[model samples]
Target: MINISLKLAILAAGESVSLFYKEQLEYFFGDAVAITAYSIENGSVFSPKNEDVYLVTTVSFECNEDILKYIPKDKHIIIGDVTFKNSTINRLKEFPINTKALLVNSSPKMASETITLLYKKGVNNIQFFPYYPNSMETYSDIDIAITPGETRYIPNQITNILDIQNRVLDRNTLIEIATTIGCDYLLDTKRFTTYFDEISNGGIGIETLIEKNSILRQQISTITKSEGIGVIEFDVNEKIQSCNNLALNLLDEDRSNLLFKVVQNIVLKEGVQSSKKTKNIFQTIYKNKKEEQINLLFIPIIKNDNVAYTYCLIRKNKDMKRENEIEKEYLKRGHYSRYTFSDIITEDTRLIKTKEMAKKMAKMNAAILITGESGTGKELFAHSIHNASERRELPFVALNCAALNESILESELFGYEEGAFTGAKKGGKIGLFEIAHNGTIFLDEIEGMSQTLQLKLLRVLQEKEIIRVGGDKLISIDVRVIAATNENILSLVKEKKFRIDLYYRLNALPINILPLRERIGDLEILINYFKKNLDLNFIFTEKAKKLMFQYNWPGNIRELKNCMEYFCCLNERIIETTMLPEYIKENIDLKEDKNQSTDFLLILEILNILKKSEKNEKGIGRSYILKCLKETNFEISEAIIRRLLQDMNKKGYIISTVGRGGSKITQLGKEMANNK
Candidate 1:
């Protein structure tokens, strides 16, 4: 048997158990074949010891895929780590060759959810191990309840168990388990009893215990207050137990005034109306008693002698906010009111030609269709076309079809009257078309709009007017329409998913933006443009530039922008070819290509011929070579090719070299080749 040891990790309520697990796993694994067990519920780590006993303070959900995400996925193991994401349950049995058995366990709720999600994801071959603390028959679905030093009594639930044997654990069951149990096991019976005993008595004693809880509350309060985040705590009775100042600040009142008042009036008075909501909220704090810093935790505290008093904690991590802020800053830079034509950038002569045509169509008040791949800047071009036309002075409205559903899109595009729906604005609202009445409206991702909405839009395009969602008023519109889609409209039309008449009306002055690969000539220009605007200084090496030109650019301009931004953040200086991702670097051949390179080299070889033929006028051809040199950025070998052709001309051979500054073909040399 493969040697395996297990370790148990425990922590006080509100402490992160993962830190201890992480430290221990790193020490034990050390880039070895060792399996590290992590409790995702409590964020704690577990490692195998020589003794084979695993101790846990609390029983939390564990899964194999989670272990793989942290370590290597292609390994064999008996016990699995737990994960909240439902996608991982199916692949557990197929881990490795040495994997003899797979153990799957879950809390009551997680069991159902995991099985359902897994079944939906097409996962089979899971052996169920339902954890019951008071069970001893070792059923196929029953595993020994996680307790300290109980490995000998525990059955190999994956292989030999009765109730949970040879059955596939699905995603729904895993989700149910992960949510209910969290990651850590609670072992302190005394603490559980103490909490339950105090809450069961149900005495409405107003004790000044805020000062006692203040120290514990301050830990989360100080961080949230300095960062402008919300933090609050509740007890088993769903009463406001404690909260940081920031939590009350977000509520626009203090803890003693607004926090307590809201809890007493709404949540507490309601008496846990939603069990699903309350269970999910309460389980995190109940399961992971060790976890202190929760990201948006909604904890529920249950108080009674039978069950321990529970605490609900909800938190949003500060790191995610910081990352979002950075992305928002970038998005803000390229956006203006309705994002008009000024945002599109292009130096391609063909695209410029297309732009001229698009602008003409825009000026004529015709419906225009823009089509291209996802990141090819279709919306930017649409905005630019609108701004360049006479509608520049008027409002330019842009709508995202994919962002809202049918009902919402209808309300957004066509004005809705007050009381149109349950939460409609009181006075009523102006539609996007109305906002751009005398100007232009751009619809982006039009393929995502429902067929019902498309039919309505076709009417708007053909009629030049619209009716409010609830009102019968036919509002006349002088709006120009520009629609863009990454999807193929013809395919959608063929599929009967989109209206053919709408496509025909919108197809007037259709513009197809060439993807980045087709216009490789513009790569250098775009790279330089991005580099100039970025906060850091980054240069591309010649090899790196060559790799850039070779990339297929699946994500188009957006990918390039993201890649350049990442490079800027990662390095201050040059981006070398080796530094690029593997796929980009693979096709790049820095070495010479015989046919193409030699032919180009022949042009530069001309310089030697000129030197031999026109010894006295050798420097005469230098200026001609200089022009070619400048074009090739002074790759001297190419200049020599032109010189060779000039020399051949003087020698009565078929060659071309002229110009007082350099080399060209003589009439006699041309005649010689013609005669031959």
Candidate 2:
């Protein structure tokens, strides 16, 4: 024999109905489970000792944050025996349309919500009355009184009484709850068996349950019939049981002929089957009026230790073309830019000037080129420009030019015909340029595009039209192009790597974004912006802020946002210098050698300063170097300059001395400056 002992607690907010529930629970699970009732208002005083305790809440709305503190989350279940009944509404409709009826509930909010639902369902004749402690005495004129099961008070004047609690629960309900919570004694009760049979065989509440199931089935049928994609269902015997209208149309067969047909008889050509047992996708030729190649996805739904049914999604082999086109419509709506010129959080003068120029360019319908290093908010600028432009109401479509290869990129930009390629969509696919008509198409990382694609893109910019990859017809498009590149496209054009014509076409309105290191003064504002958006209550210590300002953010704003997210994940209210990312903390030690480091900007600045000093005949001393740096708004310590001068002299870039003469540019330094 197995030993079983479980403790169960019933919590109610000072309601007398909890005693009835406790009595019922003891009658059912008294043999194996010990039952206890507690008023949640007084609080739970006893803690279980080496025993599993399950708590049941009598009221749904009573499970507030305060109550949750005293209870284990997984140990509690809320069971409010409040359910909608069609029979109750049907009985109400038998009275006159303008007949006055009273609806009452223990909670005012619940009563209001139920009244609203009833009104929406065309039950406008009812007057709602929430049963307060003694408010039932005022409503003596009501013809019918409706109350939830838990409400103990009802006026005697109302002749027609419909109690929902009496209809919702019975002996079967308690037995099912007991079985669900692992109290098996309730399952074997003779009264439970009798009640279960009575309920299942068209008893008092069976009609309501059947009506709910029928309505749910109707909804499922409507969904299956209206969906654009083909959906077919098969029974466990692998025979077609039901199919949607789209599936019937795709198969070119009537519902009567398709029903009950085995799946093997429908396919003419076989394809590879997936290794997984539950779901698989493979190519096959279906025998409709003729042989048609399509891709079929099989999904088996398991129930009751068997495959209850299998759902099959069918698509033509050419559907990949339409897949992205359909997804683009949804993406255009959900992923539209929520950014504008005002959204760029920066106060740096250079970035402000760039934004001002971009705002002016947003007024014109010309191809704009945004140039910056990676993560310098190039895409952000593109979004802002589109959101502020004349085409603000239309779609702002964006594509990463480097993400796709040549063949896919061409089709995605220009679109393709139905029979243009082996896997082209059934009805030809509309490309991004066509979808983005009268709007803007942002092509990020334009320098990564091949020279061949560059020539085609140039044609589109010049003619405002495109021809599909394998088609001869020209499709006119009116989209504004905004191209962004991290590389210097002018250098690429000069080297014959990028088309010069395309560069000129896209450079109608050029904008250059400054990197994060150049605008270090804006660090605090950006940090606060990120923290506010993430809704995290965190403050960076002064040392942490100072370290962040000194570090060179190679990844720019994106990296800083990621660092803030990391701090938020740590659940720390105060972010200190030691808690920062390893790279940011290490940057403090690297600051002394920054001038002598292999940073391209620092190296180029040293060479430019030396070359300029040579022209002035004022040798590049530490003071003169500092003066030149101050002129360009760069502040570096004398120690860093001394280290840079020593390293450059050793590397044959300059000749320096500790005495009055300072440093002079060497032949190699002059050569390096000229090359740069």
lDDT of each: 0.50, 0.64
RMSD of each candidate relative to the true structure? 29.0, 21.2
lDDT (Cα, 0-100) at 162 in candidate 1? 23
Each prediction's TM-score versus the true structure: 0.38, 0.40
Looking at model 2, residue 330 earns an lDDT score of 36
Candidate 2 lDDT, 45-150, residue by residue in tens? 2343232464443242223324434556456343433223456556555666656656666554344344544443334455444454455346666667676563
- How far residue 607's Cα lies from its native spot in candidate 1, in Å, is 32
Worst 10 residues of 1 by lDDT: 204-213
Candidate 2's error at 245, in angstroms? Answer: 47
Candidate 2 matches the true fold with a TM-score of 0.40
